[model samples]
Target: MVLRAVAVSRTQEDGGRSELLRGTGVGPVGGLAASGLVLGMQCALLGVGAGTGLLALEGARPADALAYGAAVCGTCALLAAATMLLAQLTTDATGARGAGLAALGLLYAGHGVWAAERWSRAGAWSPFALRGAIDPGGADDWCPLLVAGAALLVLLAVAAAAARGRDLGVGLIRFGLRHRRPLRAGGPVTLALRLSRMQLLAWAVATAAVAGVLTAMGENMVELARRGAVEGGVLGSLLGGSDPGAGLLDYIGVLAGALACAQAVVLVGRFAAEERSELVEAERGTGSGSARLLSAWCLVSLLAAALTLGAAALVSGLVGAALLDTTAGDALRLVAGQWPSAAASAGVTALLGGLWPQARWLAWAPLLGRVA
Candidate 1:
């Protein structure tokens, strides 16, 4: 009787364990699959949109649209696969997060360098100027210099971040050490502040720099606008028919800033995911609460967007004034003009990150749309 009772207990325990595993596995798999489906659909939609736009502009045939769509889809698929592979290879959370941040910084710096070089070599010529400054030799001379300098800057930043991350044994830029002692005086807000302090600071610095750059660039844009070289149409209407090269650079910077904001959103969302996936439970068992955790995560996301975008604007304004002999006041005004759109994009992304933790796949939509 004793042996039979023990055997029955063991059987029941095994059955319960199996049930638990099966139930738990379903949510993760389903979430991942859903995310994948959303991503693929968004990519397809982007391709279709781009193809349609191209057709409308050129009055291309259906076959032309079809070909363009196919190319876009193929490119999206390849990029998606590459991103997933990179994520998989960096299985360690700290490493993965660090890599993502590094990539954002590198992309921003690279695009900036590209813009500067292109403007310098193209000699204030419009893109449609068929007879102007088509010096292959000038491009060859400058392109390599820009690429090398940008690459070096990116590598240095990555290496520095990686070293710091290794020392901390966490993500390079993330805060919040696993606290051991219980809170005696201050409450959840205090905890959140402590946790997100580093991230907020990083965001502030990045945004300030980006804003400065944008402001500087705007001054130069105003000068170009004064010149009648730029045409007066839809494109001109938006960029004030400024130096086409400068306009292109401004657009690129905006796109890069948007991308960086998106990345920040994803990083914050990952924090929520980690919490939901049992990792946070382990930390909570030690003393953290949901309010403290969520606050810290959200704060980081907001700060990142504000700082990086602000920096882009500032830099553009400063550079525009110095390079194009525009007044500082005018550059500031242009930077101010761009704020609403930039803020809207960043705000929407941050809100999405908070509301839909599992829907990070959606962030890729804007990026894919750009590519298309």
Candidate 2:
């Protein structure tokens, strides 16, 4: 949302690409710092709330809960800041989001490995070791907090230094194929797809990576289930079915569907942004009407959601078959079974885009409400 807001602001200014680069102080450096701080603080508060609430329910001492909350908040602060820096350093919105999400996944995975191995000597070095420090029934320790705080300072310094050398709109890494053919005329749908193709690809890759990881760990997950580790829990209720082998596959499908729905909402919001910025308007002035352009954007947003989600489903199916002893056909069928829910979420977003383009963000309310 922050990145989208930034992108929208950038589009509001009347300037060439190079001019925006020259506005780096306000555009990249300042925005990065401010957004990072805000997101970091929010994450910290959220972690604190969740951690304290759960600990309180478990009859832990208030002092201990507060201490754990502090540790979680500190770790979250560093993570949020680091992710924001990574996002700012990326060239496009999609890359920014993807990199940040991947970094988050890596941090958690690293912490999981560090904990599961029962290795304490290297705990301080893991990016998310703070989580382990706040373990229930453990000694109250501040070492992880100290380490995270110090690391955050160093990371902030490095991120600021890195920002100094980068052009405002360019990323550290850039790759694209030059067009060899003459441009052809197209409707707003074509234009919207072109603009969003990179983001869609990034979303697909992230989804596939997550699904692949889950699929590869299917055996362990099944074993855990069989041992009654997750039996009758939320996981068991959501993923468990007649065939234990298919439980993990079903879980993946549901998760992928939710992600696809969120992506659809984001895509629609992007369409609204472009329309409000007059990018779509300019195209409409060229032998098109507002209604026609809007219809095109709606179609394009739907298509983008479908294509990206389809890619995720396909990859998940193939990966599950290869790594989890599941048939590719079954995996595909599982993903297919969940498509209508995603389509419903996208439909709500599209309705908002058509009726209240400037207020399409309200479309998020449904998803949040559903989750709550």
Candidate 3:
């Protein structure tokens, strides 16, 4: 939903490409406030909808549902604010959204790892730990929620102050600033790689981190399965259908592959960004064909997907072999299957971007749906 900021940035004259907000008689801070209000309202509506569902499902008191709703609202508003800040730190809206979603993925994965390892007490400071802190089943703790709200406010204040001092449509942190030359024309594929190198590297690191954590988590899950089996609990069968350790490891491996494919989708958005910025037309004017540009981008996304997913699977398999006595074949096969899926995602996004740049954001719909 915060992608709206980027989408709107193109239409508003004072917000377009490089125009200052004050050109519309609104200071940058005021502009932030205005957009922030819109994002907050959206978040609030989402919270109300989500809270209503929670109320229906859990039969919780209205007060508890309202509390959960506030948590959801505040967290979402914070994410939108952070995404706005990211847009100021990236060369384009796509990079900002990609990085923002990646950050959210990392936070969710960290919480997952914490939960999988059963680190209930010591991992209280983990990102999104408020889920447990706000749980009605977990003592109805509210202190952490208040602390998180305070931290979010402070961060928003800092972001607004920083935005006041920055130029429009320029990142505070950028890549290759010292290099002044335009991309060499002979190698469009090379240019694509250069453009997306940083984002790919960031995703690679994040994938590896999650792969390692999930791989390690398999052993803990196996242990819990054994405990549940002894206690005759249903969670044992649910967690580990038959072969506890190996099954959980394979599940984690496939999950890592999915993450890798999602990373590839992030690279696809760079193509969309290029189209939005008219970089595609500029390349065309320099004799680069549209088909070639898009094919090159698709190829880059595929290669990145392969490398990151392959590495993640290898890492997971190696760790599982050592820790959980699992074989590598299943992990390798699972990732092999995802190669085509990643390619498809890349092709879909690249084609949409080439044909209708406005709808390029729709590429994320399927992935978000799956995650949901």
Candidate 4:
């Protein structure tokens, strides 16, 4: 009887280990390495594409192109590493998912700052020129001071939102309910929604704030142009023929929105995978159905994209109008024009989440392909 019991116990232990492995998608080290390699290749291709395109547009030399490509690849690798580290640390799928979003938000903010710096420097107006027109010596001191102040303000606002979000364990803006009443029983869909909602909102707010700042800055370009600070007529034409600042802001906001939307799609795709794993199934077996579960996931994902983009657009429009002294109508028109492309990008991401179960990372393939 003792020997028979021992054999039965061994069988149960082996079965339990198998189930755990399947649930987490954790396999042997070889399998993990293989999966990582595949992801790296896809990301590298994207980096190459983006690098080459940027080089072509900027008319960079071969050396610059190589440098840019290397940088892109390195950045992608860093992002991947950060993501995996977050997954390991949280040991919770939802936390891993939120880390992906928070990383994207940081990326967007970084890009916005970079762009703003480049635009401000390359922009037509310098303190020297302003000094030449008015008081020469005074211009130098004030110009840098003004730009630095504005940049600092924007950065601080974004940082504050991020900090607040971390505290609340939600997105920058609160969404849905702050707290849920303890229920006698809840299912998978409810649980998924609860886990994801806060993270989604935090990401949206961070992305939107960056977009808004960039857009507002762009609206000031027309004033710069009117002052004849910008010599290049061609450049002015490209910048929307409005105030140089406003034009640049508009362009940056649109680009930022597109990028943020891509991040949102990638995020949602990952969420879907987490949902399919045994963790969600266990919750579902308790009460959840496919429709309810999927719907909640979809809603949270869509909300993240919409709120991020919408905040960006609205902020850009408001700031641009304020700076340019334009009517609300004009501002709305500019914002509206950029929406179609952004919406399409978001839709493509949603489709990928729903359609592809295995190789779900392929949803990012298109964005990666564009980089190549």
**Quick one: best TM-score, which candidate?**
3
**Per-model C-alpha lDDT, please?**
0.46, 0.64, 0.68, 0.50
How do the predictions measure up, each by TM-score? 0.51, 0.78, 0.83, 0.56
Q: Show where candidate 1 strays beyond 4 Å.
A: 1-45, 88-224, 241-257, 260-264, 282-288, 326-372
**Best-to-worst ranking by TM-score:** 3, 2, 4, 1
Off by over 4 Å in 3: 1-21, 86-102, 109-123, 174-176, 179-182, 226-238, 354-356
Q: Which clashing pairs does model 3 show?
A: none
lDDT of 2 by residue, 157-179 (tens): 77766665676556665555365
Task: Select the stronger candidate by lDDT from 1 and 4.
Answer: 4
Model 3 scores a TM of 0.83
lDDT of 4 by residue, 1-372 (tens): 111111122212222533454457643333224434655686579668866776675556655554455445544544554444343333234444555556555554545454556554343232112212222122223343344335434433443333323311123333335585664436544565566666667656666666666555454456667677666665567454645554665555456555555655544554455454444566567676655655555555555566666666666667666775655455455543554455555566566656766655565565555433
- The better-scoring model by lDDT among 3 and 4 is 3
- Candidates 1 and 2 compared: the better one by TM-score is 2
Clashes of 1: 38
Compare the candidates by lDDT and give the number of the best one.
Answer: 3
Candidate 1 local distance difference test against the native: 0.46
Lowest lDDT block of 10, candidate 3: 9-18
Residue range 65-113, candidate 1, lDDT tens digits: 6555544543343333323222323423333433444433433443454
Error of 2 at 272 (Å): 2.4
RMSD of each predicted structure: 13.2, 4.5, 3.7, 13.4
